[model samples]
Target: MDPSQQKHFAVVDYVIFAVLLAASVAIGLYHALTGGRQRTTREFLMADRSMGCLPVSLSLIASFQSAVAIIGVPAEIYSNGTQYWFLGCAYILGLLIPAHVFIPVLYRLQLSSAYQYLELRFSKPVRVCGTLTFIFQMVIYMGVCVYTPAFALNAVTGFELWAAVLATGLVCTVYTTMGGLKAVIWTDVFQTLVMFAGQLAVIVVGVQQSGGLSEVWRKVQDGDRIAGLDLNPDPTERHTFWTLAVGGVFLMLSLYGVNQAQVQRYLSARSEKEAVRSCYMVFPSLQLALALSCVMGLVMFARYCGEDHHTSFLATSKKDAVVIFFVMDMLQGLPGLPGLFIACLFSAALSTISSALNSLATVTMEDLIKPYFPTMTESRATYLSKALAMSYGLLCLAMSYLTHLMGDSVLQVALKIFGMVGGPILGVFCLGLFFPCANSTGALAGLGTGLAVIFWVGLGSIVTRSSGSTPLPSSCVANRLAGNSTVILQAVYSNVTLSRPSGLKRFYSLSYMWYSGFSCSAVILMGLIVSFLTGPLKEEDVTPGTVYPLMGKLLCFLPEHLKKKLCCVTPLGQTISACQRQPPHQKENNGEAFHRNEELDSCLPEEVSLPLVEQETFV
Candidate 1:
């Protein structure tokens, strides 16, 4: 290693890092001891459903904002420019829809796993399919989460990679198994603070060391790193306005709307209102997180402008480690800063993996194990749940070994994984909630078809990195020694060429941002078509609680005759009448009523009502 690239840590730096891990373990032990003498699955999985909005909100952010985003976002900005920042725009619809639509439906059901909705809406097979898909997705994702920081720190700072991985895996597993959801959420709260503090410290010190914000801004601008919205409508464009804003909404929906990790948080909230408020709270903090990473990239670009570290000791290091290299170099004189940054990275990884372990255990017990063992005792189930948590922790550690094989930017890789798997899952939920006519067969077919399409595209893109997108300009390497400008100009011009990819290659190479949107649309389209052809669901057979409230109003704009054809009152054991409107209190017997018919208008025709015999039987 080049002498300049080597980083040395002081005792104070080690102390700072140790304190973070100790505090997290302490929090877990506290929760373990403080809960009732006997631990229940509810206490372990849902925090007994007694959590406030603040902790849940913070924990939600911590769940998704792993070290991948912390390090990858900056690396993305540093390499590809700030065009990727437009993903922030998608957060608007992404979270809002979950707050109103997903939160209400799942929270009311009091589900232990989000896949429970699949069984309620479709069949047990569908639920198992959904649960298995989520398990595969999270298991693969946890490996990447655990591997990112350890690999990066090792590359840049000579930290022991296996040691870091084992420490994080063991610590996360201990807390998740010992303390459960309460420990996960509260530790996430503390880790979130540490994450922010560490990043903020780096950004503050980086700006000062780089000769101030004005100089940094000027340098980045000169290098053409300052980006504006890419208004191109091309789906093949990597990071355009439409892809980031519109496609991002689908990605966010897949993650925030239906993913088990977030669904668990929603079910843990004290009330429906609190759950919604917690989602709303995510906006500001998430934006701040995005901004901090972007600014960190700008400062890095400014400091390293025109300096070719690629030819230095870091030539063999992964791209993700570049951020660590710059940080250690900039903070060398300042003891403990590097350690804080490492803590931030590990903090991000640990929080995310801990959440994953707890949620995985919840789904395994609720969706898989408990269903088969209906008569099993609660104490035995709780013990089994803890065992499942430990098992997943081990699995995640094993998965970390595979992450070394992944190609492309880690941010894009993570997003691609979500889009490929999560898109179909979201589509299944959408079919259940938005289209009451969709049956189990259609849902199963749609999920299968969607997954097939996304994997085809995702795998093709990985195999051939010729995505037809324009390559980013090389990093600005400062010419420290006096050099010939003519030689530099000749070398740059020599690399300029124009070539177009084959049509099929281009199609397969469509921007990853469109993966979720395309897959979701494929599922919905295939599902509806298959459902209609294979005998659509009867209104009497549909569960009222499974349908979203907005679906009815969305169809209300149609003509009354058309509305009658499309909309029918779901059978809930109520009396049938000839298009008679009922008062609110009479219609909804209690809070269990999924739909609040505030309009009190008869929207369906008389013929839509089920016979009295069938109505009683359905109830």
Candidate 2:
């Protein structure tokens, strides 16, 4: 209990941390030196997009499951309950849509940054708009990734939060900047093992400390602490069946599927089939991970529910320290246990940050930079890409500071930030893939309107949160008046009174799970109708052939019933045309087709064609 006391970092802790850092550096340098001409934009950006499934899939898992899943989930469950795990099923569903829909679209056309699709689908402005929004989303998310683990370490070891944030952030930036995606994936594979070890260790030891499964269950039920399965249909009531399942679907879909940070990993696979397999594998693994983490949380609360829960600095200090508390207290003398646990947390944290940095750089360099800096030199591009990587990392740091300063539930904060922009972004992608008739003008207007509408809907809730909005519903008003009993008059004046709690502030709040669903649906509906009015992009406007294949998938025209699965129908319904020519393109990228460097083309997805696959050259 010494306020001035410091938990000296054991030698093993230093050794483990040092080894992880050194290994990450070694991975980067090895790829840099050995990946022939890999130091160029071709190799640095994508690893040639010829990597097999295992490493790619593993990287995807490590990226998506960040330090948040490792540390944040347990912290959340320690306060709330396993209701959070209920959303994991929804997350799996959400993730599937992107894998099936967006990745296929990107593959057929071949795009380095998914943001480039925006330009091809709608117009140049739409591409820039989507890219900018994605940058914001990635920056905030990456910031959270950095902040969370540093926050966890600060809690256990007694260090300054800012210092910890900067230290880990700067080190993560080194490999990300130097090595790009190759460094990110190799390091992710390493971090994945450490993270799995750490999480499983805590779950094992915490369960043992809480007696055993039967005793733990008995204690939880005895304490009435098992908050499981509550199915209500109200969107206003955040954890309701509607919000968690539906809204959770949109949130996870946007995150794991369409998210550039997530998609970037999948595209690195040797083939589309391999990438699909990776995502399919992650679905069940995620549920198991969530179950384990939540079980550990229940055990922690069962063990130390009423202990003097004190934390030094995190804004939401109460439950935020739960995981760290459990580790430092319950997990005592296992030799190198703390070091392993810390590495696991950092691994999760850094893995996400690694993807964020590379994706941000990829998007900026490919989508944003190519537009404005047309004369982008490779050496300068690399230099600028690294600078942008650091810039986005720094931006996340600044935003994380503001997030802690404002005070928010970590889960709520993450969802809310993304929800603010996810709708329009998802809408743009959906329009590109599903609607053949959407043009640049329509897409732009639709994106703008969709964003404005969701802001008012979601952020408006915050107003009613502070002071009840005008014409508040009777149920809401009644709910407010019910709290009138808590009001009290000061001893000096019996008549002059005001409503209050022991501490009067915005205590009642909405859950954030519904944010993404609401925004996405709003945009889809609005964008579709708007596009219908504005007319579809002419063959000249958008690069042709992009829409036809995507439309075929949406309509189920690539006949799965046939042997080849590429059969077509004639105007005479009885006659199968047997023609699947992908609707002759009016030249997809014809203007500068010959001039564009074939070397850059080889690094792209289109380079992995049928004859090449038949040869099994890179696969």
Candidate 3:
């Protein structure tokens, strides 16, 4: 297992993964055994409404950062540079939009899944449709989140790919299944620290090995790898400001606001205000973390291209493997540093897995299970929630077999799917919030059209193209012009094939930054048109009785009707508004009160009543 032996036979790398995998297993098993019947909906999923801001924020960072950032961001930096990080500013915006807008709305509604907002804004079928789509998206993405790094770990470290994917997937899935949000949040806090330390270790130790930051910068400058702030127009280039900012803004909207994994963290906050604050904190942290990783990528590239550096990237199957390769070969000297670095890799995996599982479970109970099981008691819902989490995790673990085929790593693949799904998803929400003319029928039509467009963009000819028995690597002309490489480096590079092929190759560039943009535009345009043609997507008619949350808050005035609406304080059960009690004066005006009572009754069914937040409908 000597890292010095060959590119993949690194003993230190294996030791790192092995130790972490063991720890994951121990954690998952411990939670399962100790968790017991605490598997109820509120406790298992949302941590019994007892989560604080700081830990929740830390967990939020971990849950969203996942293997995609670990593999994709560094790979992106290796290919591009710090300029690509301009997208982080867009991410900051996405994070802020949700904190100020979406999170508060959801907290007021007190729904489980964001898609439940779809119900409020659209219709029953639309809610179910959105929910199902989310499930499909989560299944594939959770698989990628688990599979990608395991695939990379095995590819570079010479472990069994199947075993690696399974090993990682099983542990993440289990703890998420057992401990729910609490486990994910607590474990994610630890993992986030691990991930940060790991990246810092690579940067510090890699730079030192390559002489110093000065040498690294010199190599980057000499190699012409520093992508200038070329704000000018370039239709042909992949990572431009236009695409990065607009595209990144859309990506953030889908990723941070709409995506269950990212949004779930906010849902677990102590209060709506707390949720908003935690979300606000997430983007800044994400920006800083990504910026640091991008810096580390430069260090890795410097080592690989240095005059003294003998490593050959031409020998590797994927250029994205550079960071991992550097760790295994170039930066192996620091004692225990490798172990910490490896631990960070798991942090990425665990954070993402936790988010996906928790979100999946939330959506399942809120959207799918709640519909037919109207009589589902709080106790019953809780039981169903844990079972659903564990079951879905197992399904994904089985699907990890496909992980070996996804060599592009997690970020690129996730973005590809997210673009197709995320943009439209965000658009659907936008239609709900902004475009009152939008209706369920139009929303449905727009969703289909948007998905179709993203599918065409992301998976070109995957439909018309016949399914092949073998996977051949794709070939593309290496754009030395954009990357600022020498004329000689501009030669075309082809996707290489191992003995195995993915038959599922994408013709698009691996740059995930553009996905959010493509999706958002398509969905936004299509959704608006569809809504305009049909009718108002507004859930309630504009009248004195309506509760206009945003406008009311913005105007610094709560509507008289809304203020008069009865607020009932009840125990956690089938009734909504566990926090407020019904006053005698308010009880007299029972019409508005009855609407919420009906909504609460819907959640309780004939089953046990769980503590739920109040429900309000706005025009």
Give the alpha-carbon lDDT of every model: 0.80, 0.65, 0.63
lDDT against true structure, model 2: 0.65
Answer with 2 or 3, whichever has the higher lDDT.
Answer: 2
> Which ten residues in a row are the worst by lDDT in model 1?
581-590
Clashing pairs in 1: 306-476, 306-477, 306-478, 307-478
Root-mean-square deviation per candidate: 8.2, 8.4, 8.6
Q: Largest TM-score belongs to which candidate? A: 1
| TM-score of every candidate relative to the true structure | 0.87, 0.79, 0.78
Cα-based RMSD of candidate 1: 8.2
Model 3 worst lDDT window (10 residues)? 581-590
Tell me how many residue pairs clash in candidate 1. 4
> Taking the candidates one at a time, how many backbone clashes does each contain?
4, 2, 19
Task: Give candidate 1's whole-model lDDT.
Answer: 0.80
Per-residue lDDT of model 3, residues 1-619, tens digit only: 2344445444665677567666655665565567443656777776766677787888878876877677667766665555677776677577767766666555655556778667655556767777787887878877777776766666566666677666677777777776677777878877887788888878887888887988888877766656666674532235677667766777777777777776666767766667766776776788778887788777866776633423444244464455566676755555566657767876788778767877898888877777766776877788788788778878788656565565444345554675567777887777666554555667787778777876765665333332222211111222235554554343433323232233343433323556556666666677777656654323223111112244334444555565334221111122323222112122111123211122433542232222344322211
**Candidate 2 weakest lDDT stretch, 10 residues:** 569-578
The true-versus-predicted C-alpha distance at residue 139 of model 3, in Å, is 1.4
Residue 410 displacement (Å), model 3: 10
lDDT of 2 by residue, 40-119 (tens): 66567777777777778778888878887787677666655556677776865776775665655565445678776676
Candidate 2, superposed: residue stretches over 4 Å from native: 1-9, 306-316, 394-415, 462-511, 537-545, 548-619
